[model samples]
Target: MADDPRPAARRRRPLRAATIGTYALLTALALVYVFPFVVSLANSFKTDEDAANNPVSLIPQSFTTAAYQQLFQTDLPLWLGNTVVVTVLVTAGRVLFDSMAGYALSRLPFRGRNAVYAGLVAVMAVPGVVLLIPKFLVIKEFGMYDTYAGMVIPMLADAAGVFIMRNFFESVSPSIEEAAKIDGAGVFRRFWSVVLPMSRSALITLFILSFQASWNELPQMIISTQSPSLFTLTKGTAQLASGALSAGSQFPVKLAAATLMTIPVAVLFFVFQRRIMNTTAGGTKE
Candidate 1:
């Protein structure tokens, strides 16, 4: 090394350059992704004319809360309530149902278990847009159309959530369950008390994802219900964007709605983001 210090230095130089380059590229990408959100937030505080004229600007010509006030004057409260109800129901249902299905698939011995899992994977691979018509037909045929059940039931369990939970469950040691069984705990008791308590990280990950998906969901909401009373934030915001709520560009109002709609999901993600990454790594290792 003393004799060839130049060679080692040269080797590290390229790596250092590469690392710097990578960081620069990532920084640029992060800015690109965040720019629109920054503009939207800024424009939300702007008057409609300012927002329309300077949509890409991060600084408003003059700031105001008129857009938010206007939004509240509309059916925003009803939309917020509906969104909260549907999102809570959907999130709770997904956590319970997805975990149960995952546990069953991972631990229970049943005929065609592999086949069922294969079907689940297949379902995940299918594009959601392709299922829209079928989902609508099923909801209508079941007489759940325009009802809360139509909005919440079909989304209660998703293939991806089941897949995540099953993988996490498989990574868990069976000896824990075995010990519970030896203590005279039945299947349901072991699942609820033993297995579930240990699955906190995975459950939180599922909860965050389920909450975000249901909160932002649009296509399903569109197909599920037409009643204004059942309209969630997504539908209401879409209406606002389409000029159903106001005339002219209404950029401030639309962006204001978008900004508000993004807050909950953004907060949830930021709070639980670390756990999500850890769960993903854990799942990968298993």
Candidate 2:
């Protein structure tokens, strides 16, 4: 009855303690990370005086929609429209181009394929800030500066998205493609009709990521275009934060813009977060 019961009990005691400690640490970290967002959301509904006086408070002293109304009266609608156009184009382009590049790197045997992939990986390691000047120069040289193309084209495909897609494509079974090949399906046909259909989770994962990245991208948007008509949400929001749209440290207006900027991406993520998790966990063969 008491055969080694103390030893087993003692072993479980440490594990239980460790688990509790881990949960406590994680809960603390979650609060730390989420506190800023909570404060921002709260302040968006607050009056300017209340927001400034109680910057970190989670409850507003007086709630009002004046900040949002002010935003709508400014260039916010134009910014939103431009952001939608650029984000939609960039997301679609990244999904298509990254998938094609990934498939080519994964399946198509070619000269310098490994070298190209290595270069792509290296590109991912470089900080984006380091490339800002170069991107600006390239956009200028191509005469894309101050144009919608400049804003959307430079961000159409990213190294990270390509890397993700390539990894996902590598996980797909070759046998499926081989069977399709036997039935006179060309590479493009196989990719478009066969492989792509089976890659729903990866595609959705890529779509969500691409949408978020393009929607929130600032440095690239700044370097890409200078036209007011081309101002995306990120760039416009930065201007609002800098007090361009109002005076007296308009925290409510700034936070309101930021809060609205977050909504679309947040909604998209909530809708497809499960698919993203599945893609990261593992792909299944059908």
Candidate 3:
């Protein structure tokens, strides 16, 4: 008997429709998400009047480098340097400490481990804003206020990052570490060579997250430091928008600063996006 093609065609029709609709929806969402950045980049090259006049437009009517020139003349360079220093230290510290804590929580069976895990989960639920005042008091009491130490130290470890690493470590095979131990490898050696290297995806995820968090952090930076020399990109940019560097609304200058601020994080995410996706899809298995 000859097979009929009608049923096959019928099955494909809805599938094709669904695929097209899905792509259309996703494309629309992508445009919506990308529109603001495009507009901001365009405005950064425009004069204040042009930006104000065509705020929603993605093209500059009159191009000018004045905003960037004016921005460079201010404390932005110093702010960038400070942001870089704090971000690198904070990211590095979080990656190291969070991974260690996570490994312990996942692999090291100890007294009150459950309690510690529960505490971390609870901490994650608590709003960071609620801790601002308490953090300030502690920093002040420690005499670390207005110092880079104050800025970098408070953000060194995050409960969420620890939780992420712990979950990733738990998913990995226990036998890997067990074998390393049987080979006479010490705890630290096993963790560094066997466990850590296998958890590359998780580590990169933590790095991207920690870098972005520290880079964009505003409240902690504000609470920790009052010195202009210690201003991060977020704080400095806020000041610029609020008329610290110039009188009235310097729209172009503010937009230019904001545009520049988004670049690093964007680049980081794109560079590691495949790694993130792969880990998310096929998480490490025991």
Error in Å for residue 271 of model 3: 1.0
By descending TM-score, how would the candidates be arranged? Answer: 3, 1, 2
C-alpha TM-score for every candidate: 0.92, 0.91, 0.96
Q: Write the residue-wise lDDT of candidate 2 on 1-286 in tens digits.
A: 6587889999999999999999999999999998888899999999989998999888888879999998899898899999999988999999999999988998899999999999999999999899999999999999989998888888888888888878888887788788889999999999998888877888898899899888898998889878888888899989888769657889999999999988898899888877782553343434
Worst 10 residues of 3 by lDDT: 277-286
Model 3 lDDT on a 0 to 1 scale: 0.90
Error of 3 at 120 (Å): 0.4
Top-TM-score structure, candidate number: 3
Q: What TM-score would candidate 1 get against the native?
A: 0.92
Pairs that collide, model 3? none
lDDT of 1 by residue, 70-181 (tens): 9899899999999999999999999999999999999899999999999999999999999999999999999999999999999999999999999888887777778879
Q: In terms of TM-score, which candidate is stronger, 2 or 3?
A: 3
Q: Compared to the true structure, candidate 3 yields what TM-score?
A: 0.96
Q: Model 1, stretches more than 4 Å misplaced?
A: 1-15, 277-286
